[model samples]
Target: MNIAIVASILTVLVGLFYKGHKNWLMTWLQNFCGSLFVFSGWVKAVDPLGTAYKMEQYFAEFESTFSETWMSFVAPMFPWLSEHAILFSVFMIVFEIVLGLMLLMGAKPKFTSWAFLLLVVFFTFLTGFTYLTGYVPEGVNFFEFGKWGPYVETNMKVTDCGCFGDFLKLKPKISFLKDVFLLFPALWFVFRHKDMHQLFSAGVRNLIVGLSIVGLTVYCMSNYLWDIPSNDFRPFKVGENIGIRKAIEATAASNVPVLAYELRNKETGHVVRVPYTQYLKEFQNYPKEEWDAEQIRGDQTITVVKDANGRASILKFYEEIPAEQLSDYLTSHFELTGDTTVIPIATTKISDFDITDMDGNEKTWEVLQTPNYSFMIVAYKLYFEEGQENRMVYDTTYTYDTIAIEGTDSVYVERKVADVQARQVSQSVYDFDDDYVARYTEVVNPVLEAAQKEGVEAFAITAYGDPAMIEDFRHETQSAYPFYLADDIMLKTIVRSNPGIVLLKNGEIIQKWPYKQLPSYEEIKANWMK
Candidate 1:
């Protein structure tokens, strides 16, 4: 639903009841603004890690922007911010909730107005940067406008700001517009806070706001920081079937009725219509995936077109012209947007959910499609090369002297005198993740063994660490299973733990455990698996 339409309806309702009253407008504005803030904050708090990941994305994009603009000094700051994004995510969640509640109850009108205004402005800036930077040409800095080129959809820095978390999908442009729209009420409350209607007694409002903050803190901690979100909104959430969902999506996407959009060349500003029926028939003639090398070599079997960046490719296959002059026969064509209808991988429940072995063979279907249950150990990273340092140690030395214990042993007696000094020392020991490897060994290893004993197939998948590192981790932790390769971001999405456990039965995710609270396999089998 368009928020603007809802606001209009709310305006009409408020006017119908409280016509001609000066406070009526303020009353509606405050209520609506407070509601939006509360709702947005609440959704984000449900999955705090998702918001943190989005923050990390923005920081990374900003880092790239800084580097592209030759601001090398400013680039380092983004990595630090990315590291603490989760903490910032939690803080922002709580702050938004508290201030929104305060605004709704008219507890601190002046403070809430200022905070809301600042927040909206900051959000507008972020969204504006994301939406506007598309107009900046390739190899051009976003801040430098003189060389800015025509609008290109492919140059967006950050795709979505995650304003409403995963509950709603707002494009970069739409998010910018939404924040811009909120500025009206935010500014009104800033200068005209005196006109705001008061609600509830002072003590009662205090109690409500205090409880809200406490609740939000606990909620964010439990959801992302300490453990997996209680309510999982991600595609890899428990009970999700990757294979089945993709199959279902493919079936649905095949028949989606679509009309070909008119092709427009941004550089030339030339627009042309595509014959809908002709395109609908021709687009279906070729396979949608990568084409054969032979066909792409010179077979006159493909139509070529240049992308928005002026890179030439096969119209259907999107093949780059071979550097070795493999193809000589090529026909140029105009690319049409919305020419064919298919569900984008992004819109589906599963996108980058792939499982590949070290040898580069896909195992996604073989794993998920099996009828028997299996266990997956997802280790996104396992680097711990920097060993513990600055450990306090006592340096002791002993010396023997003939004069010691003279009374007891007479002339030949020798006693040992000890001297001890405290020193800080660094040790290079096992560097297998100081944070969670011990936990994985103590908690997850046992579960893997138990699963093996129960005749269940289990394996490990990781995004980081080479084969040597994997072997070192296995030897150090006594893990006997083989490890496959997977995308790090996807592994994080699979489970919140670095080395989390995922149980699957015939394509459906049965259960997932973060590294912090990995249960015994027997307990899992007796409870969820059985």
Candidate 2:
């Protein structure tokens, strides 16, 4: 009834095809199980050593899962066994070879059967852990039916899984029913254990058995020696492509048109609208997707204009795309909206900010306004003593304040400052801090100043330093902006160059200014108004 049992029974039946029904099934079981032992043992020999080490790690807590009864006897000695990777690997190869050889020679099925069963039992427990921990679903069923049902259910819910010693990273959800549904050969192995001795004859039959086992052993070794299966990631293992196609067909059957829309800069805050089908054809990369095939149509809008600098302006819609397909439209740009989003307000052309603070808190501040006020965004230094000897140090933080402007929101100013700094640091380090900061002050500060003078509202800067320098660095800057910390990955993603400026209105980006050519106040105002 069980799959393994049925498969085993069928395999035995295949071996007995020429024999009559009387002793046919029994003879078939002996040869089939013998072959399986050789095959499984040889397959496992590919990375016997690595497999053993892995076994130790995953099964370290075996005693915790299983009863302490057997653990006190066999488990106590397990952990130390993994220490010598080379020795373990050698041992595994020898073990599998000997086992396979013995199985092939039909040299006492009594010994081979018990040995094979024990090995399978060990694998079963390991696989069980893998399934239970959600590493992988049940791969090779080693147990009988009544005992395996609950085990399969326990693991079937996992969607992403990997076991079989990481050679197979299985999908989490697997058909336990299919696994438990064994064929007859496996069941016959259990039933005809006493008849296993009859499989090997004295001379020629023994020779055939020896040759069969040796051949399997050689096949197993060849698989490892050449590194063949390592590259094959089981592309069709879970039928991923077929399932995706089916899901896509079902979605298409709904007859719902996918919408592609954009927001246009109609001046001021901007407006959301649908673009003409002709405009969509000219601008969209996915124009081939049917727009009117369904009752409702997908829409996408694009706004075109020129900045004060007379540069071409193209604002397009942003939507989530599949990662695999992202390369198809690699040049497409996107914008983020909603509360608590980090807007890039600068380029990677400036000094890299090593925000010592790692907290993901976005630096947000309201520009403090007094009857008499002075405001400036400072590009300040991280103290030399606080940084490493060979590392290049620079101004590590940037601050933008509204102290000079009346009615300035401190909350917004701080938030903007943090976002800008985070974006700067997000760029991977291009140069040392010392070289970068000097150039930043010489090149980027003036542009920042002009933007500040104009009612540009916000700006950001980046610098580098060790975490120990944060307080001293912050105090020395007397900055107007609140410091926000960001991850190295984030900084690297934004700018690959030096310092840059991204101007924002409300929340939408008005322009991106790299340090290559800083914008003048007149230029800033003109672009701000656009």
Q: Which candidate is the best by lDDT?
A: 1
lDDT tens readout by residue for model 1, 1-530: 44445545655654565543347678778767877888899888988888888889899988988887668789999999999999989999899878777776677779889999999998898889888988988788888889886566578877778888877778888899989999999999999998776566788988998898888999899986578888777778776666655543443444344455354454455555545666556644333342211111111122334445444433333223241221222111123233232223234336567778767789877777667888888887776674555689988888766564546655554556588899888854557665566766678887788788878988888984456666777788888787888887777777776677889887678999887777777688889977
Q: What are the lDDT figures for the candidates, one per model?
A: 0.72, 0.40
Q: What is the C-alpha RMSD of each candidate to the true structure, in Å?
A: 15.6, 22.5
Q: Which candidate comes out best when scored by TM-score? A: 1
Error of 2 at 205 (Å): 5.4
* Model 2 clash number: 65
Error of 1 at 115 (Å): 0.7
Off by over 4 Å in 1: 1-22, 70-72, 136-138, 147-152, 250-258, 265-346, 386-430
Error of 2 at 289 (Å): 51
